[model samples]
Target: MTTINYISAVTQALEEEMERDEGVFVLGEDVGARGGVFRATEGLYERFGEERVLDTPLAESAIAGVGIGAAMYGMRPVAEMQFADFIFPAVNQIVSEAAKIRYRSNNDWEVPLTIRAPYGGGIHGALYHSQSVEAMFSSIPGLKVVIPSTPYDVKGLLKAAIRDNDPVLFFEHKKAYRLIKGEVPEGDDYTVPIGKADVKREGDDVTVITYGLCVHFALQAAEKLQEEGISTHILDLRTIYPMDRTGVVEAARRTGKVLLVTEDTKEGSVLNEAAAAIAEECLFDLDSPIERLAAPDVPAMPYAPPLEKTFMMNEDKVESAIRELAHF
Candidate 1:
């Protein structure tokens, strides 16, 4: 076991996977020489050489297009988007082409590609740098959406994403890149299965379901509520698309109350989807109305630090919401 930050864990996963499989290569803006905008791909170019680690043009569409073409031709490509907000330009290739290739070809073709990007607010990235795009891509079929909150989960899930047979959109919270730290297994084969939710904190009073950086806030709130005799269960939905319905339903049923949280705007967010699922499956078990804590539906993130703070979900907000739901 090794204690590492989220960014190092991601770099380790890419290095190990590339070493294990010769076909696995990485490409993106400034990924080769600059080692990525956030250094998530640092030291990879020196280790794997220029051929395997490529620095593509600034165009997002071309990056997605090249990744899809390479994946269909038997190479595993890990394409990085400088920021999650910039991935919009590649939607045509990602949604219309890479996502539908397998079904369109009658299972004759599979796009074993992973699109990695840093997302979420809290670093004061503002506007174009701090947008959450999970819901946009998760709604599409033939795609897996993954957002890891900790170093361990990021490393393991990234490896799983690289080895999977389908296309995956992997979102890493920008704030968590260095802020979150944990012990990761010191091996190349360690992998966390996709579509499974891990209970970060076990409780009985309320179940707080969340993902990405919100998982850390939920855990913090859970810890504080414990001092007041309120047990809050926190479930981190690492993989958003193939959501762990059974785990979500079970947590809701076990606690008899639920509080869904997300950093994205509330409307049509992943929290809404989870709340709807729990409402349908565990309606009888619910003791209180499902509460969702998310950012307001606004045009874009504010550049001001104070306004950004109000726009993002934090431990204080999470704790207040949990207290309300626990009392309900």
Candidate 2:
């Protein structure tokens, strides 16, 4: 096992996949020559050549549309949106065409396309650069959404998403792309199945369910809470769609308190689903009402660093909620 940064893990996955499969290709604005907006796809263009690693024009809609077409022809395409906020322009292709192709035509045609985007705020991305739109895609069926918090998960899940028959919206937290590090087994193509949650940290007092950048935050809060004698069970749901209800329920049952955390706005957020699941399935086991610590429903992230810090959820908020819920 070797430790690698999140961005390196992503690059490794793509490199491995491209080497393994002849039909797998990557296309996006600045992906080929510029090596992605965040350099996640850095060095791929030179290694894989222009045909396999393409750089398209500044049209997200056209990029997604071309990806869908390519996928229908049995070519797996990973299309990257420079930022998650910009994916809205390709919603028609993602929602109407890519997502529903297999189901709409009675399994005649399927899109094995993966839409990759860097999501979440915290690195001063401000309004347009930072947004967590997983819930929007979550509401729509037939689209698999993945938000990986760690380098290991990012590598495994990206490989899985590339091979999956359905269209997958893979959301990578930009903040986590460099912040988090973990050991990933070196080697050929390895894949972690979607719809499974990995136990990030095992404990008994409560379960902190989270993904993306906040998983690290939750782990940090759990560590601090441990010093205060609060044991937290952390569940990292690598894939949001086809959620690992079994894993979440088991954790909720073991630790009666559940804190759902995300960078997305709390109102109409994905946390609602996780909280409701606990309430519905493990209501009798829960010692307190389900609590959520998420980004406030602000239209845009503040430019000031201090204001941004207050706007986003962090370790202190999770710790406070954990203490309150544990004692409730």
Q: TM-score: which candidate is best?
A: 1
Q: Model 1 segments beyond 4 Å from truth? A: none
Estimate the TM-score of every prediction: 0.99, 0.98
Each prediction's whole-model lDDT (CA): 0.93, 0.88
lDDT tens digits, residue span 1-328, model 2: 8999999998999999999899999999999988998999999999999999999998999999999999999999999999989998999999999889988999999999999999888888788877889999887889999999888888999999999998999999888888889999977457899999889999998888988888888889889988989898999988887688888888889888888888889898887878877888888998877888888888977778999888877778888887787777
List runs of model 2 lying over 4 Å from the truth: none
Worst 10 residues of 2 by lDDT: 186-195
Alpha-carbon shift of residue 90 in model 2 (angstroms)? 0.3
lDDT of candidate model 1 versus the reference: 0.93
Global lDDT for candidate 2? 0.88
